[model samples]
Target: MTILFRLGTAREAFDVSMTRVRGGTGTTGPPPPGRRPERRGHLRRIRADRVLLLVAAPALAYFLFFHYGALFGNVLAFQDYVPFLGVSGSQWVGLAHFERMVTDPLFWNAVKNTLLIAALQLVFFFPAPLALALLLNSIVGDTVRRFVQSVVYLPHFLSWVIVVALFQQVLGGAGVVNGWLSTLGLGGISVIGNPDAYGPLVIAQLIWKECGWATIIFLAALSQVDEQQYEAAALDGAGYWRRLWHVTLPAIRPVIVLLLVLRLGEFLSIGFEQFFLQRPSVGPETGEVLETFVYYTGFANGDFGYAAAVGLFKGVIGVVLIYAANKVAHRLGEQGVYKA
Candidate 1:
């Protein structure tokens, strides 16, 4: 009892000395004078706000510079753009270029092709990622699922040239299939250089190249779904399909809507490189889209002003589409693409 008392006394003295040294008069007293409540609160708020601003600045600058800066350059569409004269010096054509665009048969053809390809993509390509994600989610083994994911994602890193070349090598005249067919004394398919088959081929290429990567977003959303909810549903006698329909889908629905809206914004942009490279072989009837139209008009036909107008037209349509898509998302009980 005496030893315990001495130890306790020593501890108290040490604590008292430390407290005095640190300017705390009592054990439960406030912090030192240098770190007052008002000043600390100010510093904390300042730091937090600074951190938030730092995080937000890069994305804001990126949009301002690339998106809005490019938007400013759209003025050339209204002017007779000249190489010698700057955008400021260029003559204002007002609605002349827009008039030309509407009247041009080539422009109309490009618009038709773009819409057809985009629709095909929406119908065929859009659902593939969700299907893939669902299939992946069903896989029980991590090793097998990861292996499949990696293999599938490999094609996304491949360039447009490489993807087209891969298609050519497999389906071209002297390709593997044709070579096998020749050995069996069979007829050759003329799909390689034909414009008629361009739509299907491009869609197929898009699937091969982008589907796996696209599944990544859906998979991420799927990963966040509550396992307990699935368990509860299963306990309630919900089967796999029921759980998926009721639980899994509802969880990932927001992401699906978000991706759909973004895709709608890119509706007018069905890959320039792919079309440009294939156009030479298949001709413009099948390969022509807004991007390619702009390229040919400005560079091939040497009509920069008309090409800019076509581009401007596409841009406006994309903005309208995105706006509409966002509105639809809001109406369907989902958060839209943007928020104030």
Candidate 2:
């Protein structure tokens, strides 16, 4: 009671002093016309914004639950996780699994495959979407353009199983290529099951599946670019390629860099389902990427602890890579995805 009284007294005194300084009545009339509506306006804004907050609440809750909750699972990396015993009851191994992973030849092989695939993606898959976006941007007809876009984007919606099956139908042994070759008296190309071709195959598949979908973002960014810039470039005697080089590329460079940084961050995630499905036939050497290695470690070999450790390591590496990429972006005078 005494504390409340003292606080109230202090507030009252402060209010009196402020009113005296401002030449306004302490009880408040219209708050000098400027300040009165602000408080009411703030309350009105809160009321209006309440619905938006309520609408977004579910997504916020999902992010908190799934993202933040799964983050805690990283603890298993440092522990000998006994599934039956649960996390709290598990033995603390303190990077034993990490040590084992570094020593394991299979783990090293998986790492090598992942890095090689990532490099391939960076080299080939990265530029394809940008090129597609540029090509799409050149189209003057809306109906024809949308038709092309719909056709291009359709592959992205297809399931990995459907995609892989389609690939097999076209390229697998005894499929269309083999049948065509048999008719022509020529040998078929063994792409599907060939270890030598596996890396290229995955990279090509990733490009085909994701290239069009990835172009959506680039196209969006391209759409925001000023048409007048192109007009000016043309007036200045620039060709289509030159205008694109000087104007269009500059406009979308930030977005490209941002996407590239994000891709760099996910370099290890060559993909789970694709590699997992293909690895069985292609054998471990060509197909055992990090994600599949994790799945096999956990489910196949029943080493949940070790698998979790591997995953945790990958996640940490991802975070570090993203951070490093962002730093590099800043150094290059580029606006990175995540600001430091």
Candidate 3:
């Protein structure tokens, strides 16, 4: 009986192999007994996965309250909002704030600065993580690669305040490098708070802080690439660059395009904490962006209505940009943030 069972198994395996060789779908096994149990068990599995749902509850609630909840206050944009009078009591001025935004010179300057910083980040900071991931993936030594990855990823967990402080300590006028330059009788260079160099400095800070963290996705995508593809390419006389261009890049192109689309959606939101902390030092001329503009207009200057208008404007633009980017991604034959 055991010999008979073994013969039957071998015959089944051979049949499946022959089916695949004939370009069949390779699912030559017996059909499933029923689908209702699986359908019914989904709810039971959900009950079992309650712990995961509970873990995600806080984050879900946070976004619900802070993001969607705050959206109601956008009505303040069209009102001459007074803290004491509140949104309900405030007189509705209609498109006054938006009209002011269009004519405000400082607002335009802030927009220009924001665009400049965003462009710099897209051009320089965006590709740094991808390059790092590719280089790290090339390292064959698991121990060395893991050690290097850990060291690079550590900076991402640091708070923006801590990151800014570290930069100031190392690059401030009286800081370590400048002190050394002074000792060497070469004039100390100004970087931390210098307006002319602010763009590069901020981009450098972003790269240092987030580049490794960003690689987590690319590395995941790389790991999913079929090793057999690389082997086949090598057998076909493809060199390193050719194999990378043909195999590795094509495998990860979906992930790259998805990330690029998301990045473009938030092109106007450079950041708040790092720039905010350095704003006073660099002065508004160089450091002011949309976030800082909103903060100063709302909190510092008591122009809540104007600030709300600008914030709402940014949100609208963000939604539009995300939709447009996703459309472009679809046109290019890539599944973007969502399916069509």
Q: Name the regions of candidate 1 deviating beyond 4 angstroms.
A: 1-69, 228-243, 330-340
Per-model TM-score on C-alpha atoms: 0.75, 0.77, 0.78
Candidates ranked, most accurate by TM-score first:
3, 2, 1
Task: Give me the overall lDDT of model 2.
Answer: 0.80
Instruction: Indicate which candidate wins on TM-score.
Output: 3
Order by lDDT, highest first: 3, 2, 1
What does candidate 1 score in Cα RMSD to the true structure? Answer: 15.6
- Between candidates 1 and 2, the lDDT winner: 2
Error of 3 at 33 (Å): 16
Cα error, candidate 2, residue 40 (Å): 15
The residue pairs in collision within model 2 are none
The alpha-carbon lDDT assigned to residue 118 of candidate 3 equals 94
In order, candidate lDDTs are 0.79, 0.80, 0.83
Stronger candidate by TM-score (2 vs 3): 3
lDDT of 2 by residue, 122-199 (tens): 899889989999999899999999999999988888888888998999999979988999899998899999999988
TM-score of 3: 0.78
Lowest lDDT 10-mer window, candidate 3? 1-10
